[model samples]
Target chain A: MTDESMTNGTMTKSQRIGEIVETSTTGFVAVSKTLHQPPALGSLVKVQLGGEDYAYGVVAFGTTVSPDPGRRAVPRASDEVYDEAVYARQPQLTRVLHTEFSVVLVGCFEDGSIRQHLPPHPPRLHYDVHECTSDEVRRFSERLVYFRLLLDAQGQVPAEQLLAAHIRQVYRARGHDAAWLERAARQVTSLLRDDYDRMMTVLYGIEP
Target chain B: MARKRLGVVTDGAFNAGLTVRLDPGVSTEEMRIGEFVVVEGEGNRYFSLISDMQLRATDAALLADPPREASPFIAQALRGTTTYATVQVKPMLMMPRGADTDFLVDLEPPQPVRTIPMHFAELHEATESDFGAVFGHEDRTHFAMGKPLTMDIPICINLARLVERSNGVFGQSGTGKSFLVRLLLCGVIESGLAVNLVFDMHDEYAFGKESEDGVFVKGLKHLFGSKLLVYSLDEKAQARGGRGVDVTLQIGLNQIEAEDVLLLAEELNLRATAEANVGLLTDAYGADWLSRFLAMSPTDISAFCEQYGAHEGSLSALQRNLKRIERRPYVVPEAPFSVIDEMVAALDKGQHVILHFGRYDHPLDHMLVANVVTRRVRHLYREKVERYEQTQSPADKPRPLMITIEEAHKFLNPAVSRQTIFGVIARELRKYHVTLTVVDQRPSGIDSEVLSQLGTRITGKLTDERDIEAVLTGVSGRSFLRGTLESLDTREQVLLMGHAVPMPIVVQTRKYDEVFYAALGAGEKRSAQLDIVELFGE
Candidate 1:
């Protein structure tokens, strides 16, 4: 259950959609789908920061609708809007994944564009958006593959592989050029490896 | 022919019949009662009396048979009128072994048929000389009778006699008192009729060691071998320290009466108000009052008493009394503390038990041992009586348990004793088949009432006048011989004569070998010296 509803406070976009995933000080992926925005909330998004690929996260919360005429008009969908047509197109989708993913809230700029808040060190890093049919998201969430892997591995991922995958996926999905992706990946790989290695070792012991 | 003398048989064995011809020279007055007479055809010489005489006319027809042989001379003797004189013929006239005595009387005589008074006479003489010769034989010897008569004659009559009644052995020191006691106990055990318990005070009765002959020697050996359970108060005291305390002090004071406290105070001579306050406290707070009193500071309970002017000293005295009472020691037999209950259980199962308290210290230790034993015996008897009454069956024969208390005077003290365990035994043990065999040197020191209750008294020689007097008074008159009372030497005892002995007799006590008697007074002085040495040595 969302903290807003539990504590009798005004509902946030993520809380209106589903439960909130509270995070510790450590970085974690946010669910960004089934939230305030329709296609964006329902989409699978890859965030490449410091040349490291984080596992898929759904659109958790949509940006507030802007009154400015230059901003693109995003679909104004309630909880019932995705009932038949969206679900019929995604047969493998289940309600638990929608509920789990829908609680995440993504940041937005005042101009009503998605914010570019990637880690500054890897300047060429980009966001990759995959229009995850409800089936894919449901299958991913249901498998809890990455969560199980993180738990089994005690919360550590290989730095070089993660950075390479992140850059490649972001470039492919956002139609970014391979040259910039390769250069960014190359530069950040070594540094990310060291940083990730040190951070993971300190946070979770080296055995994991 | 002369008138014939008549003859009649007297004793059956003297079967000879005598026909004494009436001769004028003889007279009938010389005949006697026990004279032997002889007659023809009788086997032996017979003595006769002229029982009856009659004169009748001659009947010629009755004389049918002719005389087998011609009759001998008719010798006539003068007798009174109607005289049919009896005369036993001489033994030479008999035919042989089987001849019968016969007498012939002639109706007509050559002189005249004159009647004379009848007389019976023996044909042969039996004189005083004959008697002396037959009965008196100089070579024979007479059997010797028992000892000379005395007041203890009755006691001797019952010597080695089984006494089912409880007996007590009492006397003063140097009286060979324990010797007498040991003799009585050995008698009872040897009789194989009764089981006995000896509350051995000095351990004198404890049996061990051997004789030269290797007779599995006696003393208390039988008791020890049997179900005897020895409870040594001295050992207990040593094991527990002199501070051996009875746990009964923990019994709730609520169960105790005000009178009990008063009696206890009176025994200890505590102040009256203290006793009263004890009762009051006991009544108010119950058993925990002592703990509560102890919890109070100043070690005094009077301050806590709401009553005004109930003296503090009395209260302090009461506190001291309470502490002493709490410290009174007890002997917990392998069985339960209730001796009578344990005894009854043992008795009901026909178990023989010996409670040996041989190693106890002097006085109070003796008292405690006596008390425990007597209490158990009395309890068993009472239980049996109750059971008999309830069942109304003849099957219940209340078998008595013999409880022997050595050094009895210490525990059975009459003048000053109050509510002691031994006192109960002394008073009520008889009804329960609990017979007390009190063995003590100072018989006078024991209570008169308790001494009176002892049925059989086996008194050894008593030197002390007072102890002898106590014993004399306790024993019945029949048992007290004049000289025996004043001066009975050692090892010589007048037995029975008390309530316990059915008969009074003086008996030479069977001597036990020196080893058994040596146990008494052996270590006492040496132990005292050793104790002193240890105390000074430290």
Candidate 2:
């Protein structure tokens, strides 16, 4: 977004990428500000409730469709105008189609401390959602209690794939810390101790 | 080695021992049986031995459809979490952890484990100080036997307890049984806790013998000098070359008795009537029965049997057996001194004696001579003990004596053990100040009663199951020790158990080399200094 939003302990209007459309204690649904676009899948995103109190989640599932189920859009373009020119010709199409993503609630930041558990209350309706800064990712990944939530997610994305993606994102944001990655892998292993197939799937996905 | 962190206590029982879950960094291949380990409990520290190991996985599905071959990623990830190793620990002793551990006033000794450690107690490799605390440091009464399997510190044995009752040293052939016996004899002589009368059947104890490595090892004479005496039976065989022969032993025919013949029924191949026939001869001829019976002709034998109402066949069989003893070069008819009495006198003066069987190494010669000499010595010891008890005089009290014999099975088998002098001494439990040091290769051949009565057992490698069972006859935790005993290294390792040590331990026996010689020298100097202090009334 903007340089100001990337600074520590500060948030800016330019960094707001989505708004909450639905809310619950376990997860929430959000709509991107732009049409037919969502933040990269499995990215860390947080919603500020009030002063120094925020709720965090990881992207689990995403989709794009017309706003109304009763009305379907029919094909109106010929071979000469099938690319971006069709988007320019029918400007109203952008307003009708929207991008939506499902999030799994992992942890919360409350009273000046990062708690790796669900928030006391879900984020308010229509709150602004922003991508987590690199400092937030490093501090949150130091403890891996949130991995259990991601592994237990019952969303469209496979739980193993979602967990692996979150681990890789935090690994890169923490300057490629190999020791931290090994510890995180071991934590995952201990959690899925009885489920060897899922453990192997996650370990193979997050190699290096 | 430094005390290393091995694992934690997961589950176990008081009788079955403890189960330790190995740490992620510790591999199963690095753990070994008989290695000592320490466990930190809630309020105490436990000394345990590694008895077994196992590799386990959390899920059975992992074994059914395993990961792809050569996939290091899957193998490394599953190494410690899903699949891990566990060690079976047999906790033997426990020491309290607190201010009482200070050794200034009185050392806090390790007690037998009455309870198991708490859950998740951390286990570590035992250090040298742990060994010194459990098995005491070497001093006047405690002699250094060897070191533990993993450390270089000396594991001393309580020599005073060792001499209080009968002891055994057992192993198979070529497993250093002789070396261990020699080391023990050296300790006995140096400490002077008891006087040794060794019936050296192989002549390996008096004069130095060549070791299996082709190096010459010194015997008791080389170490004790004037304090030891060597007596040989074969004077002509003395040309083979050694030093120090204080007496050329010759047993007068009158010195031999009918009991000696009865003890050799198996070696002499006598029938069942031989015992009754020998009794008739001893009753008719009194103390000179053996010499008189050997000199009889066929007519004299028939006349004696008819007069005594004894079986003719049995009388003839007795004569045949008596001829074997008469043919021995050491046996004489009527012209020699009482060497058996002189041998007893030497033992009474606290000078150790070794009766070497120079060239007469047959079982018949060994059995007959050992039984005869030991019987006389036992009688004298019994009379002295009785006189000392009646008068309560210090001068009348006899010096403690330990009779060492090799091929112990020949003298201690179930059929003959009840009549033999060695068995009597073993059962008496130092009552008359006489005990036995039995060295044998086949312990199963010995009586189970005598085996159970042994005070301390220093055992080397034995592959036979019955032999192992016999050695561990009445010992506690026998099932655990069976595995440890069977896995001993064939060369320089032994499992020492019973009264001599605090608990059962596997030791890498100290090599009988220059290092041990130097240690012996240092021990002599220390004891000499103590003697001086006592003389000056310290």
Candidate 3:
């Protein structure tokens, strides 16, 4: 079936977040000039350059790094002082530091269909990145094939953790339908029969 | 254009098997072990049976990671991300050149599938045509033994493949081996494929036996109608006070052979000297020797033995063994019914016979009568084979005869297999239009050679590992089927395999109700049935 049908024709303009800074065939790194908080480690991220043409990816790794290579010393606000207070206290830090997260390219919505693999080309430079609409994530996840890409991904963060974070973000996005949650949990047991601890952790992530 | 897309193949060793990452909508309950499924590949569809299953996270590490308690956010994170179900399938058949074709050719020769199609779908549960092709069409002789565990598809067994050689019905006690044999016999009678002469030791097959709950279970005669002619010693009829006897069979001393008396040595507890003389006496006095030898006086016996070059002590010992048979009232010098001639005549007219023990259900009585009747039946069948061979015409060939012997190990045990006629029939009676349906509880006790020769085996629950292994003797894939047989339900369910069925399968035995009797294609079911519906309606 076509992605148009899969989206149920409800996909509108998604929330623009950042711009692409570095890219590769399997994954890419993007930097937002200032961010309240980085997108959760494994949330779905989209990079679209034009109409109906986009690359979909999972947030495999995320961190806030200073933009300039020299002078790596960055100010830190202690836990007692929260986001608004830290921003007020260190205005200079915001211009120097940017929240950067890496994305493992999972699939593409190209030629009007959802493709569960690396797209033919990387998104053009400086293309606006967005948090896929809840409906878009739901449609992309109707089949869980993309998780295989996340599992196959080789990155600094553990695939299991990234997978756990991805499921959590999707669950929060999709209204947390209990039946769907139960079904997804069942799917977890099937894929993780061995290595009980890892399965337990994954189950732990989905326990609500 | 339309089908339930099950999954996509991935991450499997092409040589070992195929692994399917199931689709999200497909639940865990669908992929069962031993279930048949069809994999859609390029230019062909492969038929496979699921052997093993697993569910796990995409990352191996996530499976064991825990804080002992699940975090709500973490739990939702794990839901659709890392977890999936995979089924391990062993491909059995491949319809090469097209995915839609139903011809099931072998998947052997080890063709390497370096990659699958872009449109590869893991598999869906096999359709009816797929199962029908694999199990074969049910013809007149093709009756379903039971339904497969995956679905309600009947597992049909070809009786022709079965009756061509010896067969065995084996299970532990109360495992419904008798009922399985009864169903098989019904198939045999319905197809008119063979005539069965059952030597009923428990007398349960010819006459209904009372269940523990005080219900009377119908016997084979009721289901078979006129097709089954029953022969008994008339003791049960006498006890029933003129309830009637179908054919009063009296095994007079005239029908006793020297071999029959020799078979009784163990039960009679006679010395080996007596067995030696019994063999000599058969050569000396011939077929009617039992009564003749018993008639001799002690002095006359010694004189006759001395003249015949036999030991005097041995002759007296043989005389002692002679008394066990001489004392039985049923073994008269003559009887109204001749067991051998009547059996041959009934078989010639295409009638199945059941020889009941009446009051003499002892091992000794059963063995003696079985030895006598089967011996004569074997000889008659051999004669008919000779006539057919000489005539070289299908019309001259006698109808195939299958003899049902309960407590088979007694007659076909390793030690007795060397000495008994039943053992030879068990091993070497595929030809001569004769076969045997040997029933026993401890199949381990039967001769391994005879057990291996069985063409079809219908076994219920057997707890003993040796009994289970012994049942799987000649069959292939012993290791694969061990768990299945070990877990059999100890009731009407049975594991039927061998020449009859297309594959090893467990089936819930068909009910022996009015429908069963009706399926036999006979007239009214016999008088033994309790018609609750008729009584209530009236």
Best by TM-score: 2
Off by over 4 Å in 3: A1-208, B1-124, B137-139, B212-214, B235-244, B334-339, B521-538
Question: Per TM-score, what order, best first?
Answer: 2, 3, 1
Error of 1 at B432 (Å): 2.4
Question: Residues B1-538, candidate 1, lDDT per residue (tens digit)?
Answer: 1212433333322232234432323445544321222232333322222221222212222134222342221101001111233333322112222322122122111121111112333233322222112111111111111111221111122222234444567655656665566655544443333456566666555444253346444555443233333334443432554222111111222233343444344445567476567766666567556655534555344556545445566666677765544444442213244544554555443334444443434454444345544544565567778898789786575655566777666566774445555556566645655566677778888888776666667676676767766776654332223235444445344433443322233444544565433532243334445434532553
Task: Tell me, by DockQ, which candidate is best.
Answer: 2
Candidate 1: regions farther than 4 A off: A1-208, B1-166, B190-195, B207-224, B234-300, B307-311, B321-340, B350-352, B394-396, B416-418, B421-429, B474-482, B492-495, B499-503, B513-538
Per-model chain B TM-scores are: 0.52, 0.94, 0.83
Q: Among these predicted structures, which one has the highest lDDT? A: 2
Give lDDT tens digits, candidate 3, residues B20-108. 77775566686555566778776666666566667856665655554345555445445435566777665655655444444444432
Q: CAPRI band of model 2?
A: medium
Q: Which 10 residues in a row give candidate 1 chain A its minimum summed lDDT?
A: A5-14
Estimate every model's Cα lDDT from 0 to 1: 0.41, 0.84, 0.74
